[model samples]
Target chain A: MAIRKEKFTMIKVAAQNNIKADKIDEFIAIAKNLVAETRKYDAGCVRYELLQDVKNPQLLTMLEEWDDQEALNNHLLSQHFKDAMATFAGYLEKPGEINLYKTLA
Target chain B: MAIRKEKFTMIKVAAQNNIKADKIDEFIAIAKNLVAETRKYDAGCVRYELLQDVKNPQLLTMLEEWDDQEALNNHLLSQHFKDAMATFAGYLEKPGEINLYKTLA
Candidate 1:
């Protein structure tokens, strides 16, 4: 049996970052600002929100939904994204893991 | 600075599973039915959808949002959820990882 590819156009992103324990507050502050700007200005951004692990506060995940690949690509190049990345660099315990997905159900 | 805890009522869940290559189709079929049932009948299930990793076909993640912890807990005890789990047991490569989260932004 083959995996069906219908309705796979929308892109969902899960960007997981391990922030330094002391920097959680700072990271979230910047992330909240980025979320606001992306939602307000980015086209085809269906959802963009940050989530903190219930058991581990240092583990932060950005749950995002984009209309398509083009919208996601645009978000990567947007000024707000770059700005947040710059600040996020110093706050992260290690490099973040970004995984892109397509809706299957 | 302290991490503010306002607006943390919503519960988000990310359940990641690795399906056997041969069982991917079977797993997805069951999952799609599970998604439909959960969305249509499960109360307080804001979002319950399956996502396939763009890079790894075997990796399937269920991205879910619930109204609160009580709703999420109720979902665990749901008959549909148990029924799906029984079929999912043999198809999985390993035990699935389920993480609960709170929206931070």
Candidate 2:
């Protein structure tokens, strides 16, 4: 059967104290490229997009959808994801908030 | 004092278990218009925009910015806000999740 719907994942990161603007740029750039790779490689994943806070632009939100939870879990553990986390660790101002869920309706 | 920056508020709604597609459209339409009004009338609010889930398209997220917390509270209690809530009550599948924040760096 065809997939009915995908879940939306909301991820947020708060800037750490005294971080520089230039570093924020570097982090975001790396994130964009890395996330693109995950989307391309994960066939079960439906779509991924990033949104920036309108006023507090430093806050980044990612929207993702997958065929099902299993597909999502697998994608999370993929090599590209692990490598990206290792590389991007230093740029974060703080640990990120991540919430994943399937569509309710 | 000149306004420095605004806080970002993120809001989400889950679809009611048996909600239909057309009602989602109605709820979103009303929301989009009502939100536009709030942005135009509330000077302390810097910006507001809505984004939909990339995979689960029915889910929506609203991004808002305000001059400060007080401004945000005032906006929440505004006449338009109450009216919108009253008008849109029937469309909700569940209570919306609302999170407010300020920029760190």
Candidate 3:
């Protein structure tokens, strides 16, 4: 790779959700609904996706893009998020990990 | 999240790069060049992003989308990938992790 100059501007949310073995299907069902709702209702969300690990299907991850920090904050505080969290109760193997990022390029 | 039905079809690649603390800047510089080149040359690449962790700047993740498995496979086999990997030598703190996924919704 040749060293070149360019700038990338984007805010991303990377999160992991580990579901119980038996509840994998159920978790996916609920998550699909959540993704659709988020895409429809949140204009700030450029993209929201749920992905399943190829090696371990039970391990899932969400990759999201927002216009900015404020937009992401608003979405997290929205009723949809609250309600989504409610439905997720007892479904996760643990709290899981979520992180934010800004593109370098 | 209300339970609703929706289908999402996309191929995503999630990868991590843990750069040596001293080489982080160099890594980003090389990465930015690679990203621009990939975006310019690849038609099947819908989106290719590089992100830095908010809490730990040394931890970086790449999120990429391709039209299908064939497109992604082509990218993996491309000269650009080979060149990029070459530039990455000795810069990593660890081997890093890369995984493929199919969106659930």
Candidate 4:
């Protein structure tokens, strides 16, 4: 079998969200909606998933995979993202920690 | 088109590693070796990618996808993991932050 080489870089962003215990259910609902909307409307999105922590259910993570930086940039400016952020502001205990990463292999 | 539903739970673990500036190259080499070995040997590993931070080059993230918790547990006990951890001890500025996540959708 021949080795397949990936020419284009794929970007991954993991955002950690710590929500209040009381707002867990509400947060999940909103997040699910946001995921659905993003996957449906955002053409650049390869994978958009909302993950909940096993130890602390209140802790949530958003794992996103995009085609490139341009795609991710477009997502940042999209109306859906803006709307999601506006609604998420109240449920967050502190600012979410978002980090960007690129795959080496 | 019919929507495809994933029956089995796929577990994801994101580990944040902050390496000393001097050890970045060495760390990446070791991490690459580990990833290659894991992919070759481990049966349960679905995806294993080493990601670099765009803003902070010293910050590294390991995004892992496994079939289940049991598979993840086995990996934790694998020789490759132990060897990698032992080698990683000297390069890290701080303890790595490893968090487990479950996808909701």
Candidate 5:
């Protein structure tokens, strides 16, 4: 394995969403598309993946790792993200909880 | 980057904890040691990271990725894991919320 020489700080995001029981499938479909687009086109995206809780299928979390704050801010303002948010408005049980974190280890 | 040839299913775990405000630093100290030990000694441990919430300092999450169920189960049963849990008992505001997930994209 090869390691990159430059040092960079990563911005980790965990966006937790709880969907209505009946709208879980619809939520996943929209989420999967959003993940695909984010990973394909978003610059400085290291990891952008959707995860469904095994015990509670209605619970979803977008686990994201970006190179820095600039990358994360750009992603939030992107068209696909806005579109996904609009589509998700009706399916959410409540507003999503987004948390930003700095890795400690 | 060198991609491995073998195919394996990963078990993603998000273990969220809310520490007592005064115990946050102590909790992080214990957690950092656990993360280091898990990464250095545990087999099939792909990622063992401790993340502190940027907005809420008392909120911490352990983001883990294991190779499969057996690996996850093994980690849960390990002495280091058991020891960490015992040490964390008094520092926590409440029980940790553990969620297992599979990547969707």
Candidate 6:
């Protein structure tokens, strides 16, 4: 097989839940919208997805890939990112967690 | 409450497996080594972890955090990363995947 350069990189984020399970849809939508704007509209982002932890629906995880850290850095500084960050932070009842990794397996 | 600045950022990585089910230990160790060196030895990294998929033992996931994209970028260029990459790339039976995200929820 011909070798090709890897186009994207991964990161994971988890939020500490305070939003009632019944209202998670409301919360999830806001987060989902934020991501779509970042990944779909943002130039550097390659792919992004939101994954709910099956063991704990309250736990929300985001899976995303970017061209590289630079592409990611650019996304963070974009105007859309600033708008999303302003309101999104208020939805979290507790501070969230994020993890970063390079594919090595 | 005073707001504390968020320190680390998140990223995720996944690997497609070709290693036999029983041989995962050996393969995992190698993957683990790459992560440890990338996170602990690299000054910019905040935390790192390797997570296994419950449904598929053959699947592996990596969870990591960095001070930010800059720290992550620094880690990527550090000598340990280069060393790890040189050998790590050969072990993978198939290409690995990575994701990047900003904690918004």
Q: Write the per-residue lDDT of candidate 3 for residues A6-94, one digit (tens) a residue.
A: 54456898788888999998888888888998999986899898899878887888889898887888888888888878877788887
Top-lDDT structure, candidate number:
1
Q: Rank the candidates by DockQ, best first.
A: 5, 1, 4, 3, 2, 6
RMSD of 6: 17.3
lDDT per residue as tens, model 2, B1-105: 899765454332211222234576776677777678987887687756555543444555565656666677777788887887787667655566554443322
The candidate, 1 or 6, that scores higher on TM-score is 1
Off by more than 4 A, model 5: A1-7, B1-7
**On a 0 to 1 DockQ scale, where is model 5?**
0.79
Q: Which rank order by lDDT, best down to worst? A: 1, 5, 4, 3, 6, 2
What local distance difference test score does each model get?
0.93, 0.58, 0.84, 0.91, 0.92, 0.61
Summing lDDT over every window of 10 consecutive residues in candidate 3 chain B, give the lowest-scoring window.
B4-13
lDDT of candidate 3 at residue A77, scale 0 to 100: 86
- With candidate 2 superimposed using the best TM-score fit, by how many Å does residue B38's alpha carbon deviate from the native? 1.0
Estimate TM-scores for all models: 0.89, 0.47, 0.83, 0.91, 0.90, 0.45
Candidate 6, residues B36-105, lDDT tens digits: the string is 6775577656666666543455656656666667777787788866775676555655666454544543
Q: What is the C-alpha lDDT profile of model 2 across A3-82, one tens digit per residue? A: 87655443321112222345667766766876689778976767565555444555565656566666777877998878
The superposed Cα distance between candidate 6 and the true structure at residue B80, in angstroms, equals: 28
Return the DockQ of model 1: 0.76
Q: Pull out the clashing pairs in model 5.
A: none
Backbone clash pairs for candidate 2 read: A16-A93, B16-B93
User: What is chain B's TM-score across the candidates, in the order shown?
Assistant: 0.90, 0.73, 0.86, 0.91, 0.91, 0.67
Number of the predicted model whose TM-score against the real structure is largest: 4
Where model 4 places Cα greater than 4 Å from the true spot, the runs are A1-7, B1-7
- Compute the TM-score of each model's chain A versus the native chain A and list the values: 0.91, 0.72, 0.87, 0.89, 0.91, 0.70
lDDT of 1 by residue, B24-83 (tens): 999899999999999988899999999999999999999999999988989889999999
Q: Evaluate model 6 with DockQ and give the value.
A: 0.04
* Model no. 4, DockQ: 0.73
Q: With candidate 1 superimposed using the best TM-score fit, by how many Å does residue B2's alpha carbon deviate from the native?
A: 29
Candidate 4 per-residue lDDT over residues B1-105, each given as its tens digit: 998986787899999999999999999999999999999998799999899999999898889999998889999999999999999999999887999988887
